[model samples]
Target: AREAGAPAAELAEITEATAVALRIRRTLGQHRVREAQLTALFDTASDLAALRDLDAVLRAIVHRAKLLLGTDVTYLSLNDDAAGDTYMRVTDGSVAEAFQRVRLGMGEGLGGLVAQTARPYATGDYAADTRFHHTTTIDSAVLDEGLRAILGVPLRLGSRIIGVLYAADRAPREFTAGEVALLSSLADHAAIAIDGARLLEETRAALVDLNAASETIRTHSEAMRRAEEAHDQLTDLVLRGGGADDVAAALADILDGGILIHDADGAELARARTGPQPPPTPAVAASR
Candidate 1:
């Protein structure tokens, strides 16, 4: 009986060991899945950088979030400077009509609050939270549709807020800390791309202004060259027409918009009429 009991005890111990090994394997598998998801997120983001169309990029961002997080809905809100309002850029059809209609202040709603604070907002029970402002659109459609979990990460350029990225699940669920970190990292990559595009636009505008200024300067310089040529012609004509005394009087007349001529010795020679002077004489010795 003792020998039989020993073998049974060994069998029980082996079963317990096998169960523990299975649990560890399961945990490792989950961790690997999470790591694979994060790797996919970064891969998608790296691919997106090659695209220049801002609208398409933003849409891709939302779509990818919904895919990686296994959420039914994803939304992106951007700050509209012209309207001084936060406007939705992407909302899966699951987004409520009310959310589409109303604009939220910088810190008013979930997305807005996330933008205002520059942090992530996570909730497993959005329906039960009074802090959530469902309004009529979401209250009837989304809440009723079973949107139980929410996550929002702010998009930023340096220290400034640009918008928010949001995801929602229909069933009550918990987001792992690793998931939140992955999302926030994705948001950071997006902000960097957005900032780069904006800076590129600004640089193009500045180049345009600089080219305009350079063109203006070139035009004024051409005008000055033309004026100088015309002045030299007028001066030569006056000097050729008059003697010292005659040229001096003419120079005085033209001096109020006139010309003076001096000999090579620096002696005052002639001032000529600005208007048509008598035709040049061979004996005038060209005013000098």
Candidate 2:
């Protein structure tokens, strides 16, 4: 059409119109991508919400991350405050055994950087990235897994960094802004799931403790009631003219131990014993 002697003004208008059409198509494609991201986030939220176990929730989060990002591997690491480091918690599509159990010190690797700073970090080529501190163990794991790209986001709970969520690819790939946002969304849900499961476990343990205390209190109360009844009965027997012998026998039966009553002159007035007999002594009776 351009070679058919078209007017300059007409050709310019056509070119502009084509450019506008391309722009509209690009905008529509972007919108579709955003829509898919939202849908995936919603589904992930649903999936995490239904999980009650801490391990199960973390596993689901990584699995969803792998699906949404289409990555070769996904995993989560939790911060160990006592150790001041982060350790691998769960993984999806990961074949490296050492990587699954690797621990990263604060500011050590990509996940460590995220945990220390509580921010997102991405690298198209992890082997060449000098922005993070590389350790022999982490480097070995990454190399073994053949991972070149990495993106990590902190699992933050009220400004406190508890852990990090990561999506990694086997080959070099630049993660886009949309992909980052989606990852952050998934991390938010994961944090909630983790915190919720922990709280529930604590509550259950508290209830168990409370129940044990209640049982103890009940047993003590029953024992106290029986002791009070025994005290009343013993007092009534004495008031009804029962002698020291009766008191000694009754006390021995109740205490399941030896009983002896003495007079003012240190003479044994009454004695009762069902089991091993305690040797009689005039000095002991005087003291009693």
Candidate 3:
């Protein structure tokens, strides 16, 4: 081009203009990617907010992670802090049982490193990565699943690291910084979903117990109301100079059972029977 006699200063200006154009194009592309990722994060938040069932929420998280990351496999592990390990809780695009059930100690493997540090970690070829502590069990599962490239991000709740979310590919491919950021954003959503689901479950259980206790209290209150009404009725009868037979009849009607009245010295005064109940014996009436 220089030999073709295009002006040298013009060529320099054109080259610089071309470089500026390339940079602009690259920035535009990056902006589009970030916009798409932000949209995905919003969608994930909306989807998770509507779900109350824990299992359903977890399934949705893994599915969304797989979709947004466009990885061959995606999975989530929940931290069992009491057990001192993070265990696989949900998976998508996984065919290996061993891989699906893999568990990692708090500081083992790439996922464990995320859990331990509460940050995002990625590798183009996990088997050769020296930045993470590898374990036989995790390695075996990765091998079984045929995963080469892996990205793991911490699922966090406030200051607590709750678990790890992963996106893995079968072939070695370096994950971009944008991809890591995208996955980290998704991981934040997943953590909120899990924590919120558990809280909802607890709330539902509490509501059930509260409802049951309320029913018991209502039943007892109803019984007490009937007793109060019966007492007031019997007192009115006495105030009106009604006889013992009046008392016996009122008691029989209200109790739905045979009634007996006795005077002092164990002498039977009156008896009433209702509903097919056998008449009270004289001995029973005298003893009342």
* Candidate with maximal lDDT: 2
Error of 2 at 42 (Å): 2.4
lDDT of 3 by residue, 66-92 (tens): 989899999999899899989999999
Clashing pairs in 3: none
State the weakest 10-residue window (summed lDDT) of model 3.
Answer: 273-282
Candidates sorted by TM-score, descending order? 2, 3, 1
Each candidate's root-mean-square deviation in Å? Answer: 10.9, 5.0, 4.5
Per-prediction count of colliding residue pairs?
10, 0, 0
Runs of candidate 3 with Cα error greater than 4 angstroms are: 1-4, 224-252, 255-288
lDDT of 1 by residue, 1-288 (tens): 345666877888888999999999999999899889878877877867876767667777887788778788887888876766577776764646655555666666577678778889888877776776555644554555467788999888788889888888887878778778877877888877766667777887899999999999999998888677656755776768845665466445444466656566545555555453554465564553
Model 1 regions more than 4 Å off: 1-8, 51-53, 79-85, 90-102, 133-148, 157-159, 170-173, 227-288
lDDT at position 153, candidate 1:
91
Question: What lDDT score goes with residue 117 in model 1?
Answer: 84
Counting only residues 3 or more apart in sequence or on different chains, how many pairs clash (N, Cα, C under 3 Å) in candidate 1? 10
Which residue pairs show backbone clashes in model 2?
none
Looking at candidate 3, what is the lDDT of residue 144?
97
